[model samples]
Target: MTDTGPRVRRIDAPRQDRQDTETYPTVARAVTAARRLVHRHPDRCRLREVGRSRAGRPLFLLSVDDGERTVLAVGGPHPNEPVGLAAAVGLAERVLELPPRPGVGWHVLLCLDPDGAALNEGWLHGPLTPARHYEHFFRPAFHEQPELLPAPDGPLAPMPESRVLTGLIDELRPVLQCSLHGVDFGGAFVQLTRPLPGLAAGFARSVARGGIPLDVDSYDAVGWDSPAPGTYVMPAPGTRWRALPDRPELSTWSYAGRYGGVTAVLEVPMWAIDAVGDARPHPDVRAAVGAAARTLHERIAELTGLLPQVPPHAGVAYGPLLRAIEFNLEVSPLLVEEWLADWSPAPLSVSRVTTARIVAQRLPLRIASMLLRLLADSGGPAADAARARARGIIAASLEGLHRLGIRWVPIGTQVGHQTRAALAAADLLLARR
Candidate 1:
């Protein structure tokens, strides 16, 4: 029921120069620019309309091929994450400058949520300040400050743009998929599919080459705090928490994983991009960031070629990795809160300890469910049974904290929510048979 055909008008041979820095005029303007770039490079680029947003905006996908392996990149699933949009647009332009290399191909789904994007267009036109922009569009925070915005009621509806992207993923089936996103106040990082030693090294090199200092701490472990250390907050009781049963199904990554390919989510801090002006700017930052993006693209291209060599059935160990991530999201809060409670003259402004305790208490059941899912997936039937036996202990610990009113969302929560929905959908898929 999604429209996966090109809807916007195409432009032919639009001028391109690094100096021709022009702020986007409007949503219309950005779409026009995207269409034009696709039109100009027809051999390498083809525009496809993927889907429509809830508000009826068309989602456009731009495909570029060098006659080899296909790589897919997408920007803006979350409306507020604009750095990816800018980077994707910039990358699209950059691709126009390079002739297709033999045996390599690329496709980009540009701004998968144009209607959501339009909502924040005012920020792009006015003061492009990061804090102000964040204050305006960050949706998760809306719960804390309900006056900020109203929650949408219904299924996890994809804006028309997102639906288009879903259709593209289902159709094109590219070997590698990257979703570009940016955090307001955080160090630069990449969210990868299981650690590939060679790929990880290349990613690190790309980050260093981009001149953005690597938060070595990020790679040290997985936790809600692991990827972006400070952004997490405690959740309230009855708050929903979920986990990825097998792998994340949001984009092509899960699909690619099924086929033994690499998929990644490249999260760049707004600070990494020179223009956002929230964090301190790095020297030669623009060049570094641009080079980093290009380098990552190149490395991904290499990985796609290498994936065929890796054994498809040789399941990689993601348990330790995901468990580390889960603890930070679900359990770390308890540890942190206990640590803070003992602090002399307790510090203000949501101490890490307090936040952790809140998450643990408020979402114990959810966390327990996540661990069970992970156990089942990892073939730890005994561990899963042991967890079931220990559920009472977990509940007691969580309930004690609940009496104190602490709460938080789990890391990789999206996977849980989507998985539930997917399971329900799968049941429906089976019933129809």
Candidate 2:
């Protein structure tokens, strides 16, 4: 059969579309692109106000329709994972221009958390390294996170943005949904609320086409099981989340039960480890996991511990930022113990090797670099000395990352992979119907 579905191709956004010299558009830049499409192409696009974020930035839902099966694309659920900000904007431009599929609709939430997104805007442009990105990364506490649910009918933190998304989920009840998320380091991978058979390979293709590999190895898979290469089923949150008393959480996709639909989480990467998918034999898998976990916890502890001793740091609000940093750092110490309590030796995967070598080496620097940035911004002798020490920490971490054979990947390619995947998913979904 000669296929005539709308084909997805890698798009090159005009330089002006970036809103800045940085290849990755900031949340503000994406918002401009989304709004421009709506205003300029009124017949094809409509913009609706979703709600206001906790920070009072207005949230919006852009509905693009020629109409096939409608899909709700979510971006910027977390500030630290900013790739979605770019992906959402790029997808909007393409969808608006593409011949609309009859009965297919795309309702895109340009960004769910502008405030959080702003926190990471520092590294959005350049020095696009793991350390640089994580330095400005900001993820809210679990209870406060919008992805957990957005909002309820009544009082429950009342995340206006999530509330807007919740309303959309209830109103649109999409056939398929995808949340664009990225990681600081590792290969590319996908997370699904439920298995989307044949989707994983599509995700791999998208990565490969974009010149990246499926992040076959990932720390994100610690508690989850992979039913397919590059596809991960996030374990239902229960005890693991509860263990962090202060950080109660719920995954946005968990609401998949409330609203019947397929949800795909496309996790791209800031840097790619080519050999992440390797299945070669190696040392004890359990040991690597344990060691990585310990090293992570120790680094977390060291940074968190240093914050208090630095004379409480001054200039620009550090309280919440520090707590946010501490929250991420605090959560890891218990992860290995939790996983290993029932750990049995399985053939160590290549991921295990990368985890011990690369991820373990670089992950710490992510948080550590952020801590150092805070210290650098702190105006004082003690702060200066701390910043100097932090420079050393970052230097050592980079050395370790290089020793582990990690390399940086282009952000533009990452965005292209993501945008094409969404378009492809939309094409396949509309075709099957």
Candidate 3:
């Protein structure tokens, strides 16, 4: 490829900020921060409305011009992973503060799925405990998730938010597409569509500098097969997506791949700092995982049978809290079934151990949070009855996390891990020129 962009000095990662990621804000707050950046620096950037969400929230694209190859940094590809919004805000601000850099333009879609994000806003401002976070947790079913929606080959029509994102990708044809995704447990890891020399090492160092470990036993660890300490390459398309025929939609990265672009997936955890970049092995991996799965199935069955009594809201939009809970209850057990199908006896890695703890504990609590939200958000005497019943479900998940002794990770350090990965990957792409 020939170069067409202007020349500039090497891009430096922004200095760590103590307060930047301290507050986990709602979608509203993220939108506000994005607007603030544009309004404050009218001479530098423009906040454009790319499209409206399915829920009617106006999706935004904050752009600052420079260079030939645009950089599309998508935040909140999945609603539960809100850390990206923080990283996006920090990145845009840093770009605004410094003079324009060459070979890239900054275009950030700050909140990709506002409806799903709003569903998760309950735990953003936190006491920052595992119990509290788990109790407030909410994630859409695979079919309903923002990125997975508008399934690549399904008969269903594309969601409004999916249309907006796809439109942007087609419009920009970026050089680097960083879809910020983080998990609730385990340690940090990197996923890239194509291997970038030295980028993985830089990523591990970046995360380590923030004092986080590389989760050795990732849920996907069994599949991706780590190339370096914490870095993983997603399996080739031919080798994966073998199941779930209904889920055929192209991911933001997959779609961008057609343009010969690179994707950087940064997965960090909300807690479990002790697992940081850990390499040590623990005993009885398979036994613990089965025990955890069995425990989760038992708890989910109880909830599955109870939620129908609570009554269904007519539309998915009407009762976000109740619907989220109901959907999770149905899907939770199915996940354990998949895990069980793939089980094998092996040395327990931190990622695997952490994964079991989360599945057994936090997964139930995720539903409990939904149940509690149904009561807190709005329910009659029925809400009270549900809350009373929810105590058992809520306790189920907490027991596992507490047993494993997972600690709460601060928002700033989590953001630091994600932001650094993006910078490192960006620099890697630049160096190729």
Candidate lDDT (C-alpha), each: 0.41, 0.68, 0.69
The global Cα lDDT (0 to 1) of model 1 is 0.41
Q: Tens digit of lDDT per residue, candidate 2, span 1-433?
A: 1233435332222222222234677777777777789789888888877788876898878888845357989988777777788788877876776776668788889888888777778886667765566566566666667777533453676567767777778878777788888876678888777765556666676677666767665656665678877887766655353234431125566664466676777888777777677757656767766666666666666666667644454424655566666666666556545545543255667765675566556645755666765675467677777677667667777776766667766667777777766766555555564
Highest TM-score against the true fold, candidate: 3
Give the alpha carbon lDDT tens digit for every residue of 1-433 in model 1.
Answer: 1112222111111222231342433446646777888677666777767666655777667766654355567766556666556555655665566556455566676676565566456667666543234323422221111111222352444334444555665665655566666543323455554432223333344343344433332311223222332112112222333221111333344445554445556654443322221223234433433332333233233322322232223224323223332343433333333333332233322222222233333233333333333334333455445455435434554444445432221212211221121112112211221
In model 2, the clashing pairs are: 67-102, 67-103, 67-104, 68-103, 68-104, 69-104, 150-162, 150-163, 187-215, 188-215
Candidate order by TM-score, decreasing, is 3, 2, 1
User: TM-score of predicted model 2?
Assistant: 0.84
lDDT measured at residue 149 in model 1 versus the true structure, 0 to 100:
20
Q: Candidate 1 vs. truth: CA RMSD?
A: 21.0
lDDT tens digits, residues 1-433, model 3? 1122333222234466434546776777777888888788887788888999877888889897656787888888778787878877767876786676655687888988888887677777766666666556677755566665555466988778878877887888877888888877767887777776666666666666776767765664446657787777766654552222222225666777777777877787777646434466756667766887788888887776657545444234346566666666766776677557655365656556666657677667777666665455445676567677777777756766666656666778877667666766665565566
Q: Which stretches of model 2 miss by more than 4 angstroms?
A: 1-22, 66-68, 150-158, 236-249, 284-294, 310-316, 336-346, 356-359, 377-382
**Poorest lDDT segment (10 consecutive residues) of candidate 1:** 140-149
Superposition-based RMSD of candidate 3 using all C-alpha atoms, in angstroms:
3.8
- Worst lDDT run of 10 residues, candidate 3, spans 1-10
In model 1, how large is the Cα lDDT of residue 28? Answer: 62
